[model samples]
Target: MKYEGKIVLVTGARRGVGRLLAEHFLNQGAQVIGFSRHEDDEAQLPGYTPLAVDVGDPESVARGFEQVRKQFGRVDIVINNAAVLTSQYAMIMPAGAAKGMLDANILGTFLVSREAAKLMRKSKWGRIINIGSMAASLEPMGDSIYAATKAAIATLANVMAKEFAALNITCNTLGITAIETDMLGQLPKDKIDAVIAGLPLPRYATAEDIFNVVDFFASERSGYVTAQTVFLGGVN
Candidate 1:
């Protein structure tokens, strides 16, 4: 119960990595709040609340935070896990697809982190962890927009680390490798296999692997750590 009494907010928590993260935090004794475009039955779980929040929209995000303030009074840790990915060659990528990726991956992280920092300031301690991707460093073919958005995630966290330092809030990025998620399932199996084969570990990452890193970043002992990006599978 290291996170006992902590209020954790996870974006895109309807499914996939976001949902897994919400569960993990709850098990650690946190009061978990999940933000998704739509809520689900899992919202009924003890210690977890799901809110409909489109992080890409400023107003929607603001309303979500308002609800959080009213219900939890504050946010202590935030995992910016909301993102949209499309793997397509730069030449053939649709404009709307690129824009959607930018909005969900980049703008979403920015808006959530900004609001999280504000709520955290009350207690003068917080953790903002952005879910990045190995694609950023790999720069895989046909992943121009997706990779760029991920790379931007790391950059955004780094800058926020400095900006939020005075508030005792640390910001960092966790660049995960391929995992069994609906999003990853959208990619070609052959492509994912090829990429994993080239990795130092050469295997699919597990939910435990992700949660381990998250725990480290959210640890009170890690207050001195900020502006860092840790990539799984030794990508960087």
Candidate 2:
């Protein structure tokens, strides 16, 4: 139980990678708080607390953390996993769609990390893991906005690592390639196949693969591992 008695907050925890991470933390004896746009019944599981929040909204995020303070007192780990992937070429991307991605993917991550850091600073120990995408560096077609948003996240992690270092809090970005999730399902079969063909590995990454890296960052051993971007797909 590496995370025994720790408090972990996972955004987008209703499904996909976020849900898997929340469950894993709970199994490791950590108190898990889930922040999602909608309520999830699975959060009823022992040691899991669900918070309905729109991470893009400052008021909503503030309210969510307020509840966390009321119930848990502090946050030990924050997994900024809530994001939206919109595929469109730069020229054809809609203005509204671009703004939406910026709000949910960039601003959302910033808000959660900002609030969580306050709680973590009190304890002088915390791990901030920002989920990123290989598309940022890969420059895949039809993902200009999505890739840009992830690129911003990687940059944010780098700067935050330095800003929060004195408080003993570490920030790192985990950039993953294609994974089996709803985000992948949105892509055309041809596009998905092309991504797989480009990967050096035979299979795409899994929720467990992402979890393994996150678990490492959550441990005491990774106290010095900050300002780094770790890619899981073996592409780079």
Candidate 3:
């Protein structure tokens, strides 16, 4: 659909791919509401509103949506992108490390998607695009917690798609490979290279690469596609 008048909300929009998604919507003339844990950046783009919010907190997610409703009146599309990759090794994982991963990746998604659906239900039309990871499917060496959370998200999307289809709403997940984002900064160079070598494609995913799929989901043409996890690694 035309984004000219559509209201889009993107989580984790302070930087990385989430920021790019927000930017794409704004460029298309949509009113964008961006939720970030960080303070609003100085280099603000037009047609976008940045709100500091931690999606894992139900109160914060609710407050963020309240502001979006007040500012844009309603939301048509929601991109759940805020996630954590702090757990490097399952054996060394701290007391609450796994719980922390679930809080941000699973519970956070549940909270935000639930709120966004409320607004979309009003219009009887909505799109929910989850930002997932290939690690969820591949289960790489040290990503047990992260993988589990994303796996849960994928299932969540599947169920939401079934329930929301009657209301003309769509829910889906995009399981992406390694992208050169802040999330990747946590790993060492050799580890990163090992990851890059695993992908069928030579290059890592760019923010633009992920945004393309998100853009497709935001379109009227994608109304019939839901509950599917589109993996965007190079021909694997």
Candidate 4:
């Protein structure tokens, strides 16, 4: 769909993949609202509003949406991209890290999607696209909590799709493979390389690769597409 007049919200918009998505939509003429836990210093572009929000916190999410409601009144698309990933064996993972993943990866997506849906229902047409991970289906070792959270998001989207069908809001997930982002930089290079080598498409996903799928999900033509998880690099 044309983003010329669409109102788009993207979580985790301070950096990496989320920032990329936000900027792309903004360039397409959408009025973009970006949520980041960090201060809103990076995005000063026209038609872009950066908000400080911790998606896992109910109050923060609520306040962020309130700002959007006052400023834009409705949302046309939402990208649930805020997440925390800890790649340690479950036995060795700290409780704090596990809880962080649960809060940010699962709870964050849940909060943002629901809040965005509220704004969307006003318009009676909306797209809720979740940013998921290959870890969800790959189930690699050393990512038990992280993987579980990603998997949970896909399931969350599935049920939401059913509930929101009549409202014209379609929910879906894009479980992307590794990309050269800060998130991937946190992992062990050798291990990541080995994992990529095993994939049918053994390469890092590019920005365009991600945009293609996101655009698909955000398209008006995809009204019938909901409750689906599309994984990249043949991971699914």
Candidate 5:
């Protein structure tokens, strides 16, 4: 288990990508702390402690990190997997929706990453994997605001990688197309069909697909792979 004894923090762990990520890390023997606004007691995952925190608020994010540090000596890895998606056409989207997207997707990621880096700096080695999306590059319909937030995540990874290189902290973005998650279950069939049709592989991503990438990022070989945006899309 590469992550044996390592303390890994994963945000948005109640469901979807985040939950899968936390499970994978724990399976690798990592002591994982999951932060989600909702409480998911039914999961009963081994070696995982769930912390309730609203990442969209800086205060909540900070407090969550404090709790993590208090419980686990140090945080070795952080997966910024928590995000909110607003799929609305640019012309019809209201200002309020745009603001909410910015608060949760962009600002929340910043706050969590910043706090996690502070803890990692003391540990001398760390891995920060940001969960991004193909929407940032593909610019899909009705995804303008969501795409903008993920693009900011890419930028955050670039700067954090350069700034923390000396401290042995690697920051990278894992950009992927749609995955089969409860979140995507909300979408209508036509929309999902259109996305799958455009995919070169003719299928959507799975939680396992995203987990493989995260595992790679947390490996020792990834030390030299900082600042890179790795696309999980099968096309290229």
Candidate 6:
């Protein structure tokens, strides 16, 4: 229970990788607050508090953190896992689709990280883990906008690492590729197969794979490891 007594906030906790991460933290004895646009009543997990908020909206993010402060006294860790991906070639990608990607994948990560840092500074120690994508470096087809957003997240995390260093807050990005989740289910079969074949591991990543890296970042032992993007799935 490395995170025992810590207060953790995870965005997009309703399902997929976010949900798995939240559960992992709770299992480690951390008080986990899940932020998503809607509540996951089906989860019904003990020790997990679900908060409804659109991370893309500044007002919504502010209110959500206010509630966290009021209820938890402080936030010790923040996992910016909320993001959206739409597969479309840049030439014909809809404007609204692009905007949605920007709003959730870009704006949402920024807003949540900004607010979480405020609460974390109170204790002079915290962990900020931003979920990133290999698409940023790989530049895979049908992922231009999504990759751009992930690139922004890595940049933001790097700056936050430097800015928050004095406060003992470490910021890092975990760029994952070909994760087996509902999000991946949206891609065409051929595309998914091709990605898997190219990966050195030659297999899709599981939620457990992501949890391993996140667990490291959330540990007190990882204080010196910041401003780095740790890519997974043997992509590089």
Best by lDDT: 1
lDDT of 1 at 208: 96
Question: Which stretches of candidate 4 lie above 4 Å from their native place?
Answer: none
How would you encode candidate 5's per-residue C-alpha lDDT over 97-182 as one tens digit per residue?
Answer: 89888988888888888888888899789999999988888787898999899999989889989999999999999998878787
Count of backbone clashes for each model? 0, 0, 1, 0, 0, 0
RMSD of 2: 1.1
The true-versus-predicted C-alpha distance at residue 197 of model 5, in Å, is 1.7
lDDT of 6 by residue, 1-236 (tens): 87888899999999888988999999988889999998678767878899999998899999998999899888999999999999999999999999999999989998898888888898999999999987888888989999999999999999989999999999999998787677878999788788778877787778788988998888889999999999887765
* lDDT per residue (tens digit) for residues 1-236 in model 3: 36998888898888877877888888888888888887787647888889999998899888888888887777899999999887567779885877788899999999999888888988999999999988887787888989899889989999999988988899999988877778888878687688778777757887778878887887889999999888787533
Clashing pairs in 6: none
Candidate 3 stretches with Cα past 4 Å from truth are none
Instruction: Give the clashing pairs for model 5.
Output: none
Model 4 local distance difference test score: 0.92
Please, what are the lDDT tens digits per residue for candidate 1 over residues 1-236?
A: 89999999999999999989999999889999999997677578899999999999999999999999999889999999999998999999999999999999999999999999889999999999999999999999999999999999999999999999999999999999998999999999998999999999999999999999999999999999999999999899
Question: Which regions of candidate 2 fall more than 4 Å away from where they truly are?
Answer: none
- lDDT, candidate 4, 4-121, per-residue tens: 9899999999999999999999888899999999888967899999999999898998998899889899999999999998899878999999999899989889988898888788
RMSD of each: 0.7, 1.1, 1.6, 0.9, 1.4, 1.0
Candidate 5 matches the true fold with a TM-score of 0.95
For all predicted structures, in order, the TM-scores are 0.99, 0.97, 0.94, 0.98, 0.95, 0.97
**Pairs that clash in candidate 2:** none
Off-target runs (Cα >4 Å) in candidate 6 are none
Output the lDDT of residue 5, model 4. Answer: 88
